[model samples]
Target: MDFPQQDPAHRTLTVVGGGVIGLTCALAAADAGWRVRVLDAGAGERASWVAGGMLGSLGEGIPGEEASLALSVDSVRRWPALVTRLDDPGVVTATDSLFVAASATDIEYLRHLADFVWADQPGTGAALQPVTGRDIRTLEPSLSSRLVGGYRAVGEWSVDNRRLLEALRATATTAGVELVSARVASLAELDDLGPDAQILLAAGLGTAALWPGADLHPAKGEILRLRRTRWSVPPPGHVVRARLHGRAVYLVPRADGVVVGATHYEAEGVADRVPQAGGVADLLADAIEVLPGLRTYELTEAAAGLRPCTADGLPLVARVDARTVVATGHGRNGIVLAPGTAERVLSILEGVEE
Candidate 1:
């Protein structure tokens, strides 16, 4: 549906999608004293519900990704205050992140990345401490002996995305944002000429169906969750990652469980369903190599979701027209980028340049 222009007299905003982006937009808009409503087709098994919730913009950034890096940095900076305002305890964890390289070339690549990041801010690269195998094991006792060297990036943190989603849902409800559970038939359904009424399309992969030729597609990611007690070994103190041949694998530990994931499949026309057995086995094998003890962990669940991806691997947060704003194409960084993205959307609605 087309959203009307922002009118000082209008109060209602109909937000499409109840995923991380949509919920965050609703909460932010409500905080700004606007009546908000959220709509979603899938209440369960959404990408936001299944994400590992790592907030590491440094680790996720690729070379020449200045825009994404800027957005991620901004979002990370806003996380502390945003979580405090939400007042949701256990939503954020301040554990540092470890990026390990199994080979000499990978270590050099990491060093180059560190150098580039440091070049942006003098003396900041000193924060990433170089580590030996001994240090790696000492830092995270669960890691295997196969790793050569790694670097610890302090201040890189993670959040429990499911819990964050729950908190946002609660806050939206408290703020009186209406929740609608149904598939949106079309964007035209949200069209309105009123200045204050806005239609925000924040659904992830679902946005593709609403806006044809948006040049968005899905990148499937499969994750496996394991029970912590099945292994006799201690858990890693921080998140563990391995720069593998083609893709990277991450081990995210939580109080309730440990998440081992994920594979980024760039195939088209794939269905959004539960993770396949082969994919789960592949992820487990990768995790087991990083932490051999994970082989003994009891498998709890396997899930897969389509991360909304764009051609340039960046997010699209702009006004498609007068009544509609597109905010999808977050890919795997939806949880990490929610706050900053919402702020930008609010600014756009208020006619402020980002």
Candidate 2:
């Protein structure tokens, strides 16, 4: 995962965590005139590495989540701009998503989602037009005949999160953000910056141990990556989501392969970051039922990561003092909200808070 080296002067900011959120924040701070260096655990198990990388929050929204949806949409809009800043446009694709229902009961849930969309966001519902089975076939010929109905979320998007993380690291390097690849015990352990230098704790779930006051916890998730085949029936296109058996599953197709996931383990008894056999079985079962072509696709990878979750499903982006900032607790939307979180942090440092 190493890249070509780049050099910069002394550090003015010390950011914890090397995930998307921390790197993006370091990049933003460097661009805003802070000589930055990122302290990273360099641990292999990070939420950004295992995320499904879907920027489609509309499909995930519910009846009482308008506020969260609004923030997520704002973050999605910031992604394209961040890509441009990285000078790498290939990291993102505006592949609007489609949500389908395979059973009669699933159709009711689709209606509920549609109702939630149209409740206040008028144009969102207009974009999410209901489609019959035939219409779905017309849009994506590979879908199975079992899908009864669905709606298209016109402006949603997805990202190759693995690539994005790489680009962020490279960009941070070029911007003079020294990356220290080691685990930091606590914020109090860091002591190199000058009196004016700032400290930002953006360590995701790692913040739970580094800054216990942050109240962060781990939400374990497992995802599967299937190698796409040219001979496959569906030909693998766009983002397809469905709840075949009351469990939510989404498939994101990329240049590398198709990512099928995920199984959420928010209750007790689910081991931290362990990929359960039952979870994998259920994910594969639901994924194959919706996209039958995936049945034959190569199972390239089965991995899991712990999302940095808070009691409330929103990231914490605020200033601790004139010289310290905190930005973590982005459970599932870490990739989507990284850029916005960076912008918010930089704004606060410049005497304005947003």
Candidate 3:
């Protein structure tokens, strides 16, 4: 669909949601000479706040999901420039990630994933490297002595998401993007912005509430934060992902501790925001198996955040109408895909095909 060219002197955008995706897009639009305002409810508990912040384009890839994998690979490549533009180097925590397996079943799954990326998709496979148990332990000495193998995804970096959010907000403010603390219960409430104004629904789970046909549902995930104490062993030097007894878990290293996560389940038709005991238990148990020293670390936080997911696991970043754009359904890859999503939004506003 083609949009009548918008007047250059009157490009106005109102972004709903103050999370990573919303802020990232708002900043980009403002920099492009668009008058932009971000409306957020200022909720303290959000998926962006509780994310593990893994930019694992390769580690997170799966077989037969070529479209999403291709998007992730392309998005991860744009992360360096995004972070550089943010001017907050301290927000990045890890430059590499290690994927490990404890049992034979886990090893088989890991091997299958390795083959899928390395053999099936050569472009995406370049980020991955198959490694033995010794190599895994050699790289992250704090990892368990369990017998198995894994892969090392080079340049798959992670960031301090909390810091990143702050940097985005600060930078966006500096760029003249208005950050309004208000809840927009419906798209009708935004009609006061005038018909010529562009409205972007990038509110994660809240996007569906604002617009129909969004095809979005919430996937609740629980994650734990462990702070290193004097008695606790040092955190791993890299992001450590593991599959144990069919459960997927990851331990992302921090300067002072580690972030362990996560347990995924359908959150549709449910309103519970509290972290489930079983989910938290499984995350801790599996994290301990991967990094045994977590027993002595302080359990700083146990939080459940809702990821807005689409049925096919691919994000929706397209123009729904000439004055309306939708950029949600990022699922668990919102941070990894923020830069690319922003780029797509700009292209849509300019009526340029991507």
Q: lDDT winner among the candidates?
A: 3
Residue-wise lDDT of candidate 3 within 1-354, one digit each (tens)?
Answer: 768477888989999999999999999999899999999987663689989999877766777677887787788888998888899998999999888898989989988887765456555467678888899878987888894888888888999898999999999999999999999988888778876799988888878777887988888989999999999889988899898888789999888999998888897543656898999998999899888989999999999888889998999988887678999999989999899999999988877863
Give me the runs in candidate 2 sitting further than 4 Å from their true place.
Answer: 1-11, 117-119, 267-271
Question: Candidate 2 at 88: error in angstroms?
Answer: 2.4
- Residue runs of model 1 more than 4 Å from their true location after superposition: 1-9, 117-126, 191-195, 244-247, 270-274
Please write out the lDDT profile of model 2 over residues 73-147, one tens digit for every residue: 777778778888888877764468888888888888888877755446645755677889898888888888998
RMSD of each: 2.7, 5.1, 1.6
**Candidate 3 stretches greater than 4 Å from native:** 268-270
Order by lDDT, highest first: 3, 1, 2
- The residue pairs found clashing in candidate 2 are none
Which residue pairs clash within candidate 1? 1-187, 1-190, 1-191, 2-190, 2-191, 3-323, 5-195, 6-195, 7-195, 7-196
What lDDT, from 0 to 1, does candidate 3 have? 0.86
Please tell me which model should have the higher lDDT, number 1 or number 2.
1
Question: How do all models score by TM-score?
Answer: 0.91, 0.91, 0.95
Native-referenced Cα lDDT, model 2:
0.78
Model 1 residue 163 CA deviation in Å: 1.2
